[model samples]
Target: MDKSVDLQHYYLELSPEPVRFDAVSQLTNVFFDDAKQQVFAVRSGGATGIVVKSATDGQNISFCMEDRGTIRSIKFSADNQVLAVQRNDTSVEFVPFNANNQPNVPEMLTHQGKNIIYGFVWVQERQVALISKAGVEIFQLNFEKRTLKSVKSLNITVNWFSFCPTSNFALLSSNMGTILTPVILKASTITKLPRLELGTSQGCSGRDVTLAQLYGTNAIMILRQLQNRQFEVVIYLLNGPGLAPKKSHILRLGQSGRFAMNIVDDVVVVHHQASATSMLFDIALGGAETEVGSGAVIHQPIIPAKTIKPYTLEVPSMSLDGKTINCDLYSQHWVLFQPNIVIDAKLGCLWHVLLKLNSLCALITDRFRLVEFLLQRTEGKPVLLNVLKEMMSVNYSGTMLPVIESIFNKLNCLYKSVLDNELQSQMALMALSTKSQSSKLSPVPRVIVDQSDAYTGVFSSITDTEQLGKILLLYLHSLARNGITANPELSKQIVIDLVRNKQFDTLHQLLKYSALNESKPLACFLLSLSNSDPSISQMALDMLARLNANEIILEVLLEKGQVVEALRIAKQMPGADSLPARKYLEAAYKTKDPLVFHSVYNFFQAKNVRLRGSPDFLKHEQCTEYVQYYQTLISTQCL
Candidate 1:
């Protein structure tokens, strides 16, 4: 059975190019207006105005907002030609932009102290819906005339309002504090709906409460902290047809005693201030319920039936220095912000992270910065080469390969220099020894001649086998671990050199550490070479025995015509006795080669004699047939 699994799950996919925007000081909100090909960012406090830039490359453009006050909230029109800005001083204004994305003078649409703007949403082109502490209001924008007209108004305090990302339904919360009724926006009609409260109003007191409509669905997530310091997130299918409650989850906070949350692709991720670990929970719309006893409908929440395993990522200085990590869902990418690094969940795919890292490496114009970031991120693990392999294998620009080749070439040159130095020193010592020994050289009697075991023949140039084995082991291990492939022909030449130079022990040691599939050819080569040396032969057989290669060993014995030894070995192994027995039967009956018929007949006759009057006496009955066959061969003068 093949036990290898696919390696795609081990690495992440990354894009070769990444878009980075310049830092905005005191930035509060960012939104993209795709129709205008521009991105708008709003800042608060000092020198406040909307900054517009090309969305593709984040280059500053000629467009800017006219509102000079502290902008409370900013929303773009559906046509991307109009802008609405709410200020902290209870004022609301609409600014219209032209084809060149240049904004004109703003027109104030404030309620004149009768209402305070809470939030707003764009339902249709040339129309805007506003939520305020007083009620809901709909306004129409006359594009050619550049004037605003009030279309509809409601008398209710809406704390927050947002439209569903997919469905046309809009969710409106009447209040941020205390238990209150929320409403739904169906076309232009407003209808009151029950709020998806996570806990009772008493347990929610003295705790922070938040509500957000999830992306791509009509579901709403209610996040609240209990008075006892436990945080819970409950998801409710509040609007649309056949919507219902889905699931609930709890959170634990540590360290600085605070946490942040973000939802992406139907999953909620929470990161705490005191630790680097984050938790992820899956929230799906529909699932089957488990069987239970029928009783009154008590409105208790059904705990979520499925759970998503939490994905843990390393954050630098988060736990030691109490630095918090920021998580946000930007353009469907879950980005985790640390002090010196940004980890996007798109990194879970191997290619995506490598390309993004390469882009970041190029952007910073420092390869060492990316290397440092990777080392710090992995906490000095051996994944540096792993990251490098991913970066190299997917690179098609023909840039990084030369850099890698040059690096390894320099390493090879250094290693060769060291080996040459060591060889020169050893040769110098050998010369000195010969010179010293020449001074006392004398011819003695033939019976008293002396000899040393020093190597002085063809094998004299070979290095120490043990030390050579160590170096080869290290080299092979490093390449294998990084998933880099050396030239196959070069590898074969190296092995051939080892065998030719009489480094059998080193070759044997290397074969032991190699993977089974990679070692097969080398094993066959070793078996062939083992015949020249008894020590090498024993080593080869020992390796085969450890690997449970019985068939090969039996083949070896049979090829040398050692039938008795083969039979003895096969007999000790259960279910292997039939092989040798069948071989002898074929030689006597089928082939009719009778030069050694007596030998085969004698073996089974001995078995019959040994098992006489026993339960297995019939097992040797084939001996009688062999005896008769050999007798007939002798009568025919064929033996």
Candidate 2:
């Protein structure tokens, strides 16, 4: 039986209908702000302008930017408060924004001769960077005065400034993509004054190539399509702290077809047109030497032996021998299949490759097959858990819950299969023993029994509750280890099972190893179940104390009026001593509790006397306040 659950809940269709201005109109650029739920697009040909629309409903908003010249690019400010529009006539315009999708100010324009603005971007809140044939110029926009002032300019003939999506760094590729300079705006001044020759794409010319880089790092990746349609993703690590590119990699993706690349941190994802499959690459500094499987190195840069370690995840994949592919950190034992690569969980990498894979575009069948292959592997649990962790880490728009549940179901089925096989073996052994013993006895009628009957008898005879508890505990631990906290239903169900079977010890053990944040739901559910049982309550409290859950511990202790216990827990916590003193003082004041007053006063008096002349005495501000207050209390009582 196909045990796959209905995945319709995770299905989401983002059908963005294309808008046709005329037969010759073409989409120039597109941008999406998930925060604002808006989509911005630039088109040219029959109509040259920008269009803003709702990302969800695809409804066009009132704001529009239309002109006769070619709309080169449409960029949103870093703050998304304004839109910067550039034209081929070297004229730049800023349209101030309003809350109601209305144009709030008159269009502010700026020009730098007739060189034609190659590209312009809103680098900062009030600053814009414009690239023209002459050089790169930075301007500050004054929304109040409706004008732009030139703040800074780099006088190098600029090709394009490839801005990092997440940071202020832009790869300034000028002199026709030969010289690459990484420039970042720092408090209105550009930092990192060095530039290097990266050279142009070997077989591609003029805007056919794509460049990608990240903020806070100097690694620049260039993706180019060859004349034969073969695509290459080249990583260039430069001009950063002990950072250097390992080698360029030729990808199997987009073989004789086009491909698109996206870089997030050290990982790069490529969506290929030929196979329609997504390939993930972990870009790092120094890695183990491996054969450049399918990729040939264009240039090899010698790097130091011991440098900043590269964050790499080992996948079951191979590279061509004696090539640029470095196998520095990944283990050699994990085997890579022709189309599938097995990833080992023990590989000391950031597991970000899994994260990148989640966002990469691929066919649904490919994703399903990938998950199935991992689940069937020997080290499937950890690898699948890592996948789950990546899914939990990001707010992905794709279907993930079904995949997670499918993993869970497969694990359960495996456990069940093992149990069934064991039961069947035990039944067969028992039946043979019975036949041998009954041979000497009277021959009973050979009554036929159904297979179901024998299986039921075997199951009923099983009494290994401990083994069952261990299995359940393993399943629960697997879920908790993977940070599956969003599924409160599953968590609650498991807690109920544990509590019903009086398995407090196993529950405690499971909670002990789990992360504080990830174990919250199970811990909370355990507490709720402990209301009627003293032993269960104590176990839960002990687990919470070991978890260092200061907030809940303090709340429980105070509610129980266990002042000494609460004091101990509080003292064990950082900067919590003052809490118990304040609480006891408040109790003394509110209820005229003489016992509480004396206890708090006496403790403070001893602490004050012990540290009276020491330098550390003044540091205990809470102790000082309590000492004075207690002294006043005693004096007033004496009067």
Candidate 3:
């Protein structure tokens, strides 16, 4: 057999049968063992298992073992040599893996019960920080000496606990307060710091408290409360020092049927229902609130389920560098969920078959997985250049440009392969996609603006009237084409400048060429201009009313001393009955024909309105006389 076929056969031999834990079972927890290059998942039942696949060879070694009670939590040791299993029965067990270059049976390490394990972290090879419902415990294991010891225990019952990266201290959150304590591994001593009281707010329930990473070195604790029978978000700081109590910054999520929170550094990413929206907040060390992005939903769901349930969905996991978020979505195939994935800010690399597959395209949604895939493919500038060219040709903007630029910059800085041609192409595409011109006719000369320059006092005092005219025209064209609503004063100023520069011809061309119909607000402004003239006004009014603009033409004629001609034209216009009553009556009076007067009177009466005016004036007399004549005309016509 071929070497590849032999490897496949070996893998097939090691592959376990697909075991469905339960029909209603969901994978409640997943831990990626980076050291061993394996993924362990615990389902709702006490089912525990590990899928050990070589990151290089793509070979599978599956292990499934039954544990006592439902598995509440699961984790792998830092070295990936041991797996920790926490059960709902308040028991904790450590399953040790032998690295003896042969198949071996795993041995259980610790079996202690206090309360359900809420959180746990392996501090080193021998020490582990474990949090339970009752409090926090430190356990030490000396494999070299074959000994395990229960170290120190804390007083307060911790709902959750996390260790700081640099110190032996662990952050603990409980119903009473949040505490940071130093871990004295040898002596089993814990020196507790001042407690940061979360206070007695109904929203600060122990179960609803969740943590999310922010942009800085801070983390946010999202406390959900039942107010008026609806869940509301009360955000608090987690990484900062203890301070006096203050009102929590409440976010009115407005009865989100379901929601999920994820922390990436100091940015808290929240996805909620009520409005299918995602929000990012900058968590500060002092507990200050700063919302980053709030609008539409940008990220796509990994598993697009119909109903919103209290289930955890793993998005792309971020790396230590805080740049890329790795994502894996299993569509119809299980192979897609294979591990050995790294999604950096600029690149995503998936190790398959000893080769790295880089993804150079991003999906419309800000899915970490897709982003990582694209980044990996385009981490080299050449790939990014090709993508930029394609995107620019199609006029795709927003997420496309940012993703491309980010990858381009990263590749340019990291890889020497990024050539000038690729960089130039990316820059050109960004300019094309994001550029807003001030003129189309008198197109302004391009002047590169440094992105790093602040836009404070950066007003251009252009001495060239030609350039000014070009800029104004570009601005107007952009407004019309993009449907951009400028401030009233700014719009008026632009129009004044255009008029002063005699750029009406350019303006007229822009109005005619706009993708938006001439009836739109921007188009209306151009039509209202005095220089727009009779022809433009007539066109605009016709488009706005979806009619012949006969009334507008008549008004123009009246202004030019051609009342008789206007009246003649008005009478011939289509849908005469649908014309404004005032215009019909005025045209009838202008015609000075009794029959015309009678028609106007009959039309107004049919519309259920009495002619209002003196019967002496020609206009008034015409209306009054027509009403009487209209009745007789109607009776005669019926007979």
Candidate 4:
């Protein structure tokens, strides 16, 4: 009846001799050279180069020039036969891997002005697109004819750069501080497509701009700005023509520590963290505002041992179809070393099931067949069932029915057996009571000791209340569809017992039933019950907020309007004070209601005190000024 599944899988883990390189700050790039059967790494801060043989072999290679400064960028040629290395302070080198499978002496490529190449991509075996402080430059190589050409140079400051996979179009970040410009390229001709001006340039760190394609047509950029000494993500979408560039939408990710965005087909996978655990959001560029998939941190090796083990092995993976996402626990083996197989079909099947489960109705028959196929082929290998349960909960109408029914049937049978045992024990007690009354020469009382009382006594004998609650949960869930409302008081008592015992699963079922009914008393009771549990309080608040419970919230706030209390609840509920604040302010301005004005002014003062006049807060002066002036007026009146 708990209906929760354990989602754990084995991932490759490697315990290497913690190799540290001065130049190897982080693994910035990874590319497989099929022709050479090798993998190359570009170390960001140091001039050294590290290369490892493909997972097929376990050989390590390092290349460095004592005088080459730091490696700014490195890219592999399309044919995987050549490596292009760009160094800090505007220098380029070409290292060719020879017949011995080792990098040969570096060949100088550029002899130009100080061109700080920030990023580059190998367009073809010959041509490479590079971004510098000056502008954009295209370099070409001709192996057959032995020719190199500078095809074109665009004179515009580019802060960030990325090329379309299938097109000549290159996305350039407008050096107008933080604004972005998309440019269409046709061989030698460069046309600026359009620019979308997002937020003001203030506090925008140009270094944080990351570019990726969103749903093919749109260009997505994630911008970071310093807020309260922390970094937050500001997502921007740019599409359409140069004159009328459409700003699709903007989202403010609260308290995101570090973030990474990668586009796969129509979906964008956003990896971010607010606290200890990393959160993954599978965002559909073409669909609704809500994310398609959500997952939490499962494993992180980078965290220190002193800190809580924030990393779990569950890495959430999104399918290319944009329908399903799964969280998988990778073996420490796979995490450190490359996997032997190209793909884990079992993991693939689980991911497919998660995506299909997103659409419950469509997945019912189709998903069942797919699951059957996986079970047959896999032969009962444990899959990531946690992700499967989350998906099933969302789309639980058609396809979920059979799965839920199967689980429910087993639980129901178990509960019925337990109930039968309870019934027999109660009968035995009544028979004993009858015999004792006759033997003692006492009149037998008409009142009977029922099974509920006997069951309570049996549960009281158990040492662990937690186990007892779990048993009761299964029993309660088995009765969910049997019209428990026929005995509302009994149902209410059962819910209270579960709540008191911290049996959340049963409480959730009861809340679900309460929400389904249209009765006000039931709704209020459910809301109160939800309010009692912190886990369900947000759900209750959202439901009540939808019901336009502004009056109710305001009334409660007036009695408990301590600054801390007001701020705590207000922060949780966006636009919490908007309605009440405006109403009170209007009453004060129009009717000269001192009490109303004082309350409105105090709310504004509370916010000002909390925010402490930050610059970002100052930018929205109209809203801030109105509240400040009203508060000042109240201070004058009180004086």
lDDT of 2: 0.48
Worst 10 residues of 2 by lDDT: 300-309
- Among the numbered candidates, top lDDT falls to 2
Arrange candidates by lDDT, highest first: which order? 2, 1, 4, 3
Q: Which scores greater on TM-score, model 2 or model 4?
A: 2
lDDT by residue for model 3 (102-164), tens:
223344666566576766767676567676777667788665555567787776666566443
* TM-score to native of every candidate shown: 0.39, 0.42, 0.38, 0.39
Compose the digit string of candidate 1's lDDT tens values, residues 1-639.
121221222111222333333333445445443223344466555444556555344456444443376666666665656777776645667777778877766443443346666667676676776677777777777756656677776776666554442444445554353343445553355555555433445223212333344434345444555577665554555545443334433332322345444443233455444443344443332223322442211121112111121233333474775543323322134433211112232322111122122222333333433343333222222333434333343232345544444433333333344445566666666788464532332222111100011112111223433344544554455444444443344345455666677777776676667521233454456567766665555555666667677676666655555555656676677675244444554454543446544555566556546556332224444444655576787799875
Per-residue lDDT of model 2, residues 1-639, tens digit only: 221221211111111222221112234544443223344555545544555654335456545444546555565665556776665556766777777756554555555457767666566778877767776678888867756788887776666666553445556666666776667653356554467565554422333333444323445556666567665665555545334343344333335555445443333455444453445454332224433552433422211111111232223446753233333323432211111112222231111122312222122234434444444333344444444334433343235545545544544444444445566666667788464532222222112111222123321222224443333344454444443332445445545655676666655665565422335445556667776466666666777766678778666656656555666666677765345455554544444555565665565445546656432234434446555655677788842
Q: Any residue pairs clashing in model 2, and if so which? A: 287-328, 288-327, 288-328, 291-320, 292-320, 293-319, 293-320, 316-341, 316-342
Candidate 4 stretches greater than 4 Å from native: 1-5, 8-49, 52-70, 97-108, 143-147, 160-170, 184-191, 224-234, 238-245, 262-269, 280-639
lDDT of each: 0.46, 0.48, 0.43, 0.44
**Backbone clashes in model 4:** 22
The per-prediction CA RMSD against the true structure, in angstroms, equals 24.8, 25.6, 24.8, 32.5
Model 3 reaches what TM-score against the true structure? Answer: 0.38
By summed lDDT, which 10 consecutive residues of candidate 3 come out lowest? 450-459
